[model samples]
Target chain A: MSLPEDYLRYPLRRRGMDQDRYEWRPRADAPRRAWPNGAKVAACIVAPLEFHMLNPSGKPFKHPGAMQTPYPDLRHYTTRDYGVRVGAFRLLDALKRHRVRITFAVNAVLLTRAAPLIEAITADGHEIAAYGWDTDTLHWGGLVETEEAARVDKVRAAFAAAGLAPRAWLSPARSQSFATPDIVRAAGFDICLDWEMDNTPVAMRTAAGLLHCVPLSNELDDRKLLIDQRQTEEEWRAQILEANALLQSEHDRFGGQTLAFTLTPYVIGQPFRIWALDALLSALATDDAVWTATASELVEACA
Target chain B: MHADPNLYDYWPYRDRPRIAWPGGKKLAFWVAPNIEFYEFDPPANPSRPGWPRPAPDVVGYSQRDWGNRIGHWRLMELLDKYAIRGSISLSTALIDHHPEIIEACVARRWEFFSHGIYNTRYSYGMSEAQERAMIEDSIASVEKATGQRIRGYLAPALTHTERTFDLIAALDFWYTCDLFQDDQPQPLKTKSGKVVSMPYSLEVNDVITYGAMAMSPWRYADVLKRHFDQLLQEGERSGVVMCIPLHAYLVSQAHRIRPFEEALRHIASHADDVWFATAVEIAGFYREHCWDQTIADIDRRGLARPGVGFAP
Candidate 1:
C-alpha cells in the first residue's frame, strides 16, 4: 500500500472554480438583510423553457421521459413541445391567479421557435433570464473559454433582439467549467443562479466585476422531485411545505432567506401535477410572510 | 463508450415480463454497505488517477478510515434495528487490516460480496490474467473470512476494464451491480455463464446524494422516501428492485446518521408491500424462477441474437 512520489506532481484535476473566487462566509454570519415591503422570506419561482434536440447524438433520446424506442422519437419530441404549447400557458395562468411573478430561464434558441410564448411571458410581466443557447450545446466537457464567451455573446444578442434585457444566467443542466463564473460576469449578467453551495446569496469576484450567486434548492426542484425521484404529488406538496417551514425558521433565527423553486414545464406541466404547483402557490400566497419575487428583484434587494 | 445493444436486449418498459417476488411484493429492497479500507498511498492506474488531492492524502484516507472506526458501527446498529441484513460489499484487503469489522459483519449474518482488494486499487487497466487473479483472491478471502461464497461483484469505486463482465461471468458470479440501465433484474450477455444485472442505484446512493449532489441530510431522507414511493407504485405492475447503497463515511456522520436511520425506518414500515432481501437472495430467486422467462421474452421480441454472446 505504498506509492511513488511522482504521483504527487501530477496535474491537479480542477472541476469548478477555486475557493478564491468567493470568501468563506457562513449564512449565519452574514449581515441581516430584509426583503422588499418588510417580507420575512423571499420566494422565487424559476421556469426553464428548454428545447431538446430531436435526435441527440450518442444517446438516442434527450431525457428520461423522452422516447426510448427508435430514432426520430416523435413521442418525446412532441411531449417537450407540449411545454410551449400547453404547459407554459398552464403555469402562466396559475402564476396570474396567485398574483406571483416568476422568471422564465429561457434558452436563446427557444426564442426563435417559440417567440409567441416569449411574448406571452413578457406580456404577463414575468422576467426573462438567459439559460443557454440550447440544451444540446453545453459548457462543461472540455468546452474552451473562447467558445463559451462566443456562446454567451450570442445569447445576449438573442435576448436583445427579443426586446428583453436579461440580467441573470443559469446554465443548462447547471453544467459549467472553472471559468464559468468569470465568463458569466464578463457576459454582463449581474447574477448567476447555478451554484447551489449555500442557502443565502453570496457575492463572488469574477475577472470582470462582482457577480451575485443566488442559491437554488437542488433537492426540491420539480425535475428531481417528480421525474428523477418519482415523488408522488402528495410528497411533492409536502416537500414544498416542509422546505418553506424550514426556511421560515431559519429566517426567524438568522435573518431573511431566499427559497428558489424551480419548475420545468415538461415535468410539472402535466395535468395532474399542475395542481400541485397551483396548490403550492396558493398556499404561499395566503402567507403574509412570503414575498414572491423574481430573481432580479431578490438580487437587487440584496445588492 | 455506449453500451453494446446485444449485451442487454431491448425490453421496452411498458408491457414486458411480470416478475413476482416472494409474498406478492411489488419491489425487492436491499441495502449494500460498502465497508472499505483505503490505503494512504497506492500504485496508480494508467487509466485514472487515485485522488483529487496530492499523495499521502491523509484527509481522503482518514475520512474513509473513519467509516471503519466509528461510522460502520452506528450504521450497523440502525440496520439491526430495522431488521435489514446488509449485503456487505467488502474490500478484500479489509480481511487482513480490519478483522474486527469483518467479524462484526459476520456475526450479524450479513452476506459478503467482493468490491475489490482495496478501495484504492482499481481494475481499469488490468490484463485478463491480472483481473482473474484479483477475482480468485476475492473468492478465497471472502470464503475464508465469512464462510460464505461470494455471489456478486461491484467494481471498486465502479471502475471497470473492457472485460469486467465476461470475467465476472466466467468466474460464475450470479449478479453484478454495475449495469444501471434498468429498474428490474435483466439478463446480461456474458462469455460463459448467465449473469443478471441487479438494479443498484447511483441515484439513491448516499455518497452521490449527499456528497456529490450537496444535499442536506434531511433532504437526503426526503429523496429516499420519494424514490421508494414511486418505485412502489410502479411495482404493482412489475416487481422492481430498490437498492440503497451506503458508505459509512458519508451517511454515518453524526449529523447525517439520524436522517439515514429515519429513511430506513420509513422504508421498513412498508414491510408488507416490499420484500426485504439480500442481493444474493434476489439474484438467486430471479435466476431460479424468472431468468429464463425474461431471456425468452427478450428473444420473442426480436431484440437480441439467440446464441451469440456479447462481443464487447
Candidate 2:
C-alpha cells in the first residue's frame, strides 16, 4: 500500500522559535553600543543551582538535564545533588578568587532547601535569576499556561521574600512552549537566557513588551561538553579559549557581543573539571576586552 | 506497514556475542562519504517537499552541486591522506551525471553502497513495486558502473518503507545502515535471509553536527575526538563500531576541512586499537563467526520474533 499524502502533515514540521516573534537581525545592523565601562565583550557566567527530584513523574517525555533511567536512580540523583553540596561551593570560591560576580540561575526549591547557600550567593553581590521551581517541573513538556504562570509566581514570591527581584529567567533544560515568552513577560521578566539561536541579543516581541533574548552558548555548556560529549578537561579548556578568541574577533567588528558561559555546578564542580573553570575565570578576569558581569548587568547595559 | 518492532533481535550489550575484527582490533571504524545527486527540480514524493523553499532553488541546488564539483575532491584527498577507505553511499543518478566522481571512487578501491536514485526522491510514498524497482535499479546501475554488486543499503536521506529491510534482504544485500538503535552490529529479521544492521551514526554525522546542531568546525573536531575516545574505551570489553558519516558540502569547506582532518588524524593515531574496516567487512566478519551465536542468544532471550511494524 502506498503511504498517504497526509502522513507528512501528521508529524507536523517542527517550527522552532517563532520567526514572527523573533525575527533575524544581522549583527552588523545592531546599534553601536558599549558594555559597562566601554568593554568590548560582555561575559555573563550563568551558574545553575538546581535539584532533580528523588522521584520524577516518568511522564514519557524527557529533555536534556532530565532524569533518565528509572526511579530511585541514586547514583545519578546524588551526582546531580552534588552540585549544591560541593560543586556550587567550589564554583563560588573560584569566582570569588577571580573577583567575578556571576548570575546564579536558582531553582525556587533551592531557596528553601539550601537557603544558606542562596543567602551566601546573594551576600557575595551576585545576581539571582529564576531557573524554574525545580529541575523536574519544566515549562515546555506539556506544562499548561496557568501552571507555568504559577511556577513563575512561586519563583518570584520566593525571590521577593528574600528582598530580591530577579530580572532574568533561564528555564531549566532550556525548554519553552509557544506561550513561554508571553507568560514570562506577564510574570515580569525582562531578559531570557534560554534562546541559543544567535550570538547577539535579539528582541523578542511579546504581549507585554519586547523581551530581550540574551543568547546563551549551547556548544560551550558544561553538561554538553563533559557529560554528553565526554571531552577531556584539556579539550574543555581549549574549547573555551577557541570560542572566546573567535567571539573576540567578531566583537572587533560588531562591538556589542555577549559571551555567556553556561555552567552546571554538578558537571564543572568536580575536582578535575573545576580547575578548567578556575583557568577560564582567571583568564577572563585578566582580559581587559572582556567585561565580566552578571546577566542582569549585561541586560541593563544593552538596554 | 511500519518498522518491525522485532526487526533487531535484542541481546544485552554485556552478554552479546563477542565480535572480533580483522586485526584483533577493539573497534570497527568506517567512514561513509555520501556522494549524492540532488536535482535542481525533481518529481516530488507527496510525503515531503524536495526543498525547504519552493523549487528551482538555485542556491540550495548549487550548494550541494558544489560538493560534487569541488568539495568531493578535497574530501577525497583528506580521506586518502589518512589512508582511510570510504564506503561511498552513492545516490545512483550520480553515475549518469557525474561518472568521473564514481570513476575516482572506484579507482581508490572504495566500497559502493546504494543511497537511492536521487537524494530528493524519497521512498516515503513509493508503492511496493516502485520500491522494488528502485532497489533493483540500485543493484543494476551500481554493478554496471563500478563492477561491484551493492552489498549495503542506506535509504535516501534515511526515508524507508516497512518493506525496506525485507526487500534488501531479499535482494541479497549484506547490511543496512538505517538502524541507529545499537552500538554493535546485530541481525535484522527478514523473510528471505539474514541482513545485519551496522552501526551508522546520525550523532557523529557531519550534516547533523554542523547543519542541524550549528556547531563550529573546531567543535565538530572536538566532538569527533571525544566520541572516538569513549568508543575506544568501551571497545576494550566487547568490540564497538564507529561510523563517521560525512557530506562534502558541509565538511569539505575550506576552513572546515583542516579541522576535520585533525579529527581523522586523532582517530588514525590510534591505529593499533581500531580496525578501519568498511561496513561490508564488519558485517561479513560478524556473519561468518558471531552471527549464529548472537542470534541464538537473542532467540534464547525471546527477542527474535516476527515484524510489528515500528519502522525507524
Candidate 3:
C-alpha cells in the first residue's frame, strides 16, 4: 500500500503552532516511549452502530445512482439493523472478555429499537449515550429545530428500559443542535461529547445548565477511514495500532491527560474487521497503563 | 414502524424551534467546490476485452465528473462580489489531481478543509495507522493547495465512526465543520481536548435545498434572507452565528448561478448587521464570548489529570 505522499510532512502550517503542543518523537523511539510517570490519558472507545434496518422501516431505499437496491427486508445489503444487533452482542462479549466497561454512543432511533443491545451495554458495566437519530435526515434538519422533549424521551426511555440512565449524549454524526445541551440537560444528562474544541474534557454550557463536554474526535471513525476505498485487513490493524501509540504518547506527555478512541460497529462490526480490532485490543490490553473504562467513567472522573 | 407523523412535521417544529442564546448574526459561508472527473482511457477494464464499458460502481460513471465540475472561475467571482470568505472542503485527491482548482480557491483567499483524498475512498474499515496517514496526507494536501494551513476538517458526507474524535484531537485542528450540532457554534468534547463544532447548516446549502430541487435564484435568495433575518433577530438579543454552505458545480450551473448572484447582492445589502466572514471567524467569536467556559471545562476534563482520570 502506497502511503499518501503528504503524510511525511511535519508541523503543518495551518495548525503548526497547535501541532507543536503535542511533541513528536522520531519514528525510531515512537513505539517504546511511555507517557510520563505522573502523566495520564483518558481514552474513550465508542462503537456507533448503524441500526436503521432494525426498525423494519428505515433503510436506504433511495439512491442517487445504480447502487444495488436494498431488499424489502433489508437482507440484500447488510441488514440495516443487523449491524446494530451484532454491535450489541459484540459489546456484551467484549466487555465480558476484556472485563472492562465501555460506552455506546447511540442514535435515538436505534436506541429505542435496539432495546436488547442497549440493555447488554448497560448490564456489562457500560454507559448509554445519545448519538442523534436518522443520521442523514438529522444532518439535513440541523439540531436547532429537533423536538427536545421527544428526543429526551426516546433516549431516556431506551436507557430506562435497560435499567440505566445516560448522563451524557453525543449528537448524530457528531452534529449538535444549538439546543442539544438544553435537551440533554433538561433530560438530565450532566455532560456531553459534542465539543471537538480540545483534547481534554471541559465544562460546557447547555440550555439547562453547565454540562461537562469531553473533547471527542472523528479521525478513527470507519466512515472517514473507508471513504474513498475499502481498507484491507492489515491496513485496518495498522490504523488502530497507530492510534494507540498516539494516545499512549500523549498520556505520557501530559501530567495524566485523558484521550478517547471512538468507533462504530457498522464500520468495524464486519467479522473480518472485528478480527483486526480484536487483535489491536489485545495489543492495547498488554499496555497495563491503558485502563479501559466507559464514557461515563471518563466523564464522571473528569467532572 | 413509520416515522412519527410529528417527525415529518417541519411546520410546527419550525415554530417551536428551541429558543436559546441568539444563534448568531455573523455569517461564515463555506463554498465546497467538489471536483469529480472521469476518463475512458483506452483498454478500459483489462479484465473484460471490449466489455461494454466500465464498472458503474467501481469507477465513476456519474452525471458530472469531478474534474470538469470544480474550480469554475465564474463562481469565485460571485463570491467575491459579496466579499464572502469561505472554506473550500476539497477532496484531497481532487486538489492533487487538478492544481488549477486549488489555484482558483487560493486566488479567492478561501480556506481549504480536507474532504479526504477522493470522494470514493471509503474510510470505513481503515486501521489506526492508515487513518493517521490519510489525515496527515489530507492536511498536507490542503496546505499545499490553498497555501493556507487547514485549521478545520469536514468528513466526507459527514459519515464517520467513533475513533475519529480522538484522532482529530490528536491532530490538533482548531475547529472542524464536519458536525451539525446546533444552529449556532458551541464547544463539544473530543478525545484530546475541547474543540468547537462550528455549527454548519445544510438547509441553506445549495446541494439539497437547491441542487436537488430546482430553486429559482430569487426564491433561494429569499430563503437565505429569511434565515438570515431569523438569526440576525436572535443575535440582536443574544450572540448568534449563521453558516451557509455552497457548492461550486451546483451553483455555477448556468440555471442556478442567478441565485448565488442574488444571494451575494442580498448579503451586500445588509453588510452592517450581518457580518460576512469565514467559519473560523464565527467560531472564534463564539469561542471568545458564547463558549469560553464550555471550552475550558472540556480541556480540564479531557486531559489526563493523574488520579483524576476516568469516571467510576
List per-prediction Cα lDDT, in the order shown. Answer: 0.79, 0.79, 0.54
The TM-scores of all predictions, comma-separated, are: 0.57, 0.55, 0.45
Write one digit per residue (lDDT tens) for candidate 1, span A200-290.
6788889999988888878888888766675666688888888788878877677788888788886676544666787899999988888
Each candidate's DockQ:
0.03, 0.03, 0.02
lDDT of 2: 0.79
Off by over 4 Å in 3: A1-303, B1-63, B66-71, B211-218, B288-290, B295-312
TM-score of 1: 0.57
- Candidate 1 positional error at A145, Å: 24
**Docking quality band of candidate 3, CAPRI definitions:** incorrect
Ranking, lDDT, top scorer first? 1, 2, 3
Clashing pairs in 2: B3-B309, B3-B310, B3-B311
What tens-digit string does per-residue lDDT give for candidate 1 at B2-98?
2222455545344557888999999999999999988787888765567777678888888998998999999999999988999988899999999
How high is the lDDT of residue B216 in model 1?
82
Score residue A290 of candidate 1 by CA lDDT: 86
The A-chain TM-scores of all the candidates are 0.92, 0.90, 0.71
- Tell me what fraction of the real C-alpha contacts between chains A and B each candidate also makes: 0.00, 0.00, 0.01
Top of the candidates by DockQ: 1
